[model samples]
Target: MKVAPAPSKAEVISLGCRLNISESEQIRALLADENNVVVINSCAVTSEAVRQTRQAIRRARRNRPDARLIVTGCAADIEREQLSAMQEVDGLIANTQKLDSRAWNVPASSRPVLAQHTRAFVTVQNGCDHACTFCIIPKGRGSSRSLTISEVLSDVEHHLSQGAAEVVLTGVDVTSWGHDLPGQPSLGQLVHAILERFPELSRLRMSSLDGVEIDTDLFDLFAGEERVMPHLHLSLQSGDDLILKRMKRRHSRKDAVDLVRRLRKYRPDLAIGADIIAGFPTETEDMHAQNKSIITELGIVHGHIFPYSPRPDTPAARMPQVDRAIIKQRAAELRAETQKCRDRWLINLIGTEQQVLAEKDGTGYAPSFARIQLPEGTPAGRILNVKPKKLEKGLLK
Candidate 1:
């Protein structure tokens, strides 16, 4: 006799970026009661990312043969023709329509509930308008868009009510927020509105921002606001001016260094994070050296290093390509540099008191985003004041 299949449930496998993760949460809530549905919210940031997406699709299919496998997100849209041909996928949702109620065939009243997270991710912006030569995200995400101030306030309030101790404002180009809205208000004004409206929000953090786009209001908050966590992650793709120019980046190398220096003057404890690419097209040894040194120059304790991976239809891909081996080596070097800086920073934090928000993974994150190991069985989402006595394998204990 044939056995009956397991009960159907909705599962979203999200790949790439914090914004994708946040969007997946909304999709999860929308399909909470739906039957045998598995959604692969894919990524195509790099050729490797697309390969991983395909791998994820195949693995998901093998594991859940009876489930309805749907694909969405950047990969679904950007790599549309390729992914649609995969036998494992049943359908594809446009990246823009993935969040719409009608696309999911769910009721319009379905409320977004982030029950699994301790800190909520509130997306205030989406998409990018800039056309950096090396980037293909704009094509995948479409033009920039901003949620109105009122909508942002409602999002923040909802997360606060759900016991989220911290709320992160995330987007593809977060600093680009408010540019398309009425009067084209600066992101600073939007940030000010959120802080003013929600007095109960204990911690307000920002995701990656373009250094050049930071407005005066936002700068002042970073400098003076205690509730605003002392961390800034800049989208500084390269440190060599020539490489930056080739990438069509707005800021120069000095501009980033100067911004960090100025911010640190007012908020000495501010930690710097950056996204630095390695082995970009036409990069010389001096250029690679500049990329490595910027880590130290910016005091970048948190570094996201991406070895240059050419995406289809990008200008940089057409330029003289860097050897794959060299790219791999350079990426490793960047990681070592970042690790050295981070280890030293973590060591210095020993004996200092930190306000940590607990997570289910037996660890918590301090406001500086430092990982601190918690005592076993500590409740998730509990804010603990921890004076770490030692550092253990990259974790403060």
Candidate 2:
């Protein structure tokens, strides 16, 4: 069998989440042997994110003076004209176009070099249908769509062939998958299908999920499937009931707490993570306190804390604004609390044996997604059975 040639030197600078990283791999494959081209797959979750994207474009141009630079991703889709106005950018591609091979004039035979060796992120779904008041993602990503079951299985086979130990299903709204497909299958069905088809797949993981949409099959898999990783990152934006309502989020504090509690009952070692926004429009001190308390109450070891930044044209941007100083302060407080939670979890794992997938430079991640530094010269992409002896800095030693 003829092996695909190694990826060429074309640069792909990815910003934002794992979904963008997955798409960047495709961009790299499409533009592989092409000369003097740099692709910036951007993120536009917040205004600060967009600013950083622009800064990256400038840095890329300065470093490679003659390269033809192209910008794509959510930022390009939402603010095409603004990015086009920048002198450094030679072309612009939309979020949808980024995944389509025809947009890059490349054949469909080109396959992505999934990043980090140990794991591959397969984008099973895209876009969001829910209209959360603070979000601009649906406008940037358009309506939700999904890849067919066969298409996803093919990709999984390819990844496993390349020796990926884990495959993480990613999307703009992962739980919203299959709504556009035949029979209106649930995300749970997709998970069950993947596991059934590929019994050899060692580990399967998922990106962020919305608490409200998790179906019965998924919950059962969470409870009984040992192959599925025990960590879950939830899209729990706020913990205050009034703030959640104001943000148009689907779940309340009680709902989130109850879901975590129930999942923990099924798998005692389950590690819960969450995304929280600090100081949304009209948020008060009591509301921020509730957000802080829920981090401890729910035992969320992994926390993605974002200081609320109003995006242009979003409903929250037009609502009564929180003071910038207050937002910064509240975000700091949340970060500090998150550190304490993380530390407590790590300390609890001191003498436990963990199955770790080595990523690079003698470092790997346990099933709970905690980083662990291993013995020297351990090959990347190898899974090892390790007994964590100590906590050094923030990593397991």
Clashing pairs in 1: none
Please report, in order, the local distance difference test score of every candidate based on alpha carbons.
0.92, 0.90
Model 1, range 1-397, lDDT digits (tens) per residue?
Answer: 9999768789899999999989999888889878899999999988888999999999999998999999999999899999999999999999999999899898876356766578899999999999998888888899999999999998888888888888999999999998898899998898889889988887899999999999999999999999899989999999999999999999999999999999999998899999999999998889999999999898899899998999889999999999999999999999999999999999999999999999989999998899999889999989999999999888899
lDDT of 1 at 71: 98
lDDT for each residue of candidate 2 in 1-397, tens digit (9 for 90 to 100): 9998654467999999899988898788777657678899999998889999999999999998888898999999888899999999999988888878777766675565544467989889999999899999888899999999999999899888888889999999999999999899999999999999999987999899998899999988988898889999999999899999999988889989998889989899999899999999999999999999999998889999999999888899999999999999999999899999999999999889999999877899888898898989999888898988999899899
Candidate 1 displacement at residue 107 in angstroms: 1.9
Model 1 earns a TM-score of 0.97
TM-score between candidate 2 and the true structure: 0.96
